[model samples]
Target: MRMNYEENAKIFKAVSDQSRLKIIDILSCGERCACDILEYFDFTQPTLSHHMRVLSNCGLIEVRKEGLWNYYRLNINNCNKLTLFMMNLVTETKDCICNDKSKCTCK
Candidate 1:
């Protein structure tokens, strides 16, 4: 399903931070426990939790609780939606009325 602009914006915001981007990259490899994820970073547990919360809230990642641990993985469905949104944003264009005399570069 297509996501609304606000939802897409949230996803963009979630990835705006370097920490969160790195978190997503880690999750991209496969599902991993929160502790395992923490090992890959130098930040505190709370900081990692914050990043995970943002990613989960934005629908960019999914989380599962097993005992005292939270496992995370990239949400493929939402990722695909985000991909389509980006593709449309970059490729969808309006027709321009530029001619040779206008010096417009739209080809």
Candidate 2:
């Protein structure tokens, strides 16, 4: 599979934060309301909102509105893509970038 470096970089950046990683772990269990997620941290609601926005923007999580509440769940497709990306990144394959060394200037 071809990888889009820029898109994958954005995903890596979004989850770089400790708080965001925890949030993803929480959502991994199942869908949750914003309020329910907020209970997991000591930060203000706005902070949680910021983290949620980052996760949402990166396509890692999906959000839905139910009256005054916003529900969140992991985007399983994107999560699986990320897993595949990581696996491809580490494992050698015929398509590996290093295999195309024609661009190499070193003797």
Candidate 3:
């Protein structure tokens, strides 16, 4: 499968932050309520909300509402896509970008 540079970049950028990385790690175990996630960090609710928004926007994590609470979990499909993308990025495949000499600007 081909990888979309722009979309993958967004996913990488979202996880670039330390806080967001931690949030992703936390959600790896299972779905967690917002309150439970907050306990792992010293940040405020608004900050956590911001992290969740970034994660959700990048399709890294998913959220659902139960009453007044919000629960979050890693998006398995997207996560697998990311894993495959990373592997393809580092591995020397027939379709690797470097294999296209015409795209090279320098002689």
Top candidate, metric lDDT: 2
Put the candidates in TM-score order, highest first: 2, 3, 1
lDDT for each residue of candidate 2 in 1-107, tens digit (9 for 90 to 100): 99888999999999999999999999989999999999999999999999999999999999999999999999999999999999999999999998889977889
Model 2 residue runs over 4 Å out of place are none
List candidate 3 segments past 4 Å from native. Answer: 104-107
Q: For candidate 3, lDDT tens digit of each residue in 22-41?
A: 99899999999999999999
Superposed model 1: Cα runs more than 4 Å off: 1-3, 93-107
Report the Cα RMSD per candidate. 5.5, 0.7, 1.2
Q: Which 10-residue span in candidate 1 carries the lowest summed lDDT?
A: 92-101
Clashes of each: 0, 0, 0
- Among residues 3 or more apart in sequence or in different chains, the pairs in candidate 1 whose N, CA or C atoms overlap within 3 Å are none
Q: What is the lDDT of residue 37 in candidate 2?
A: 96
Better of 1 and 2 by TM-score: 2
Worst 10 residues of 3 by lDDT: 98-107
TM-score of each: 0.81, 0.97, 0.94
Model 3: per-residue Cα lDDT at residue 87: 96
**lDDT tens digits, residues 1-107, model 1?**
33377878878988999988888889889999999999988899999999999899888999999999899999999898898888766663442223234686665
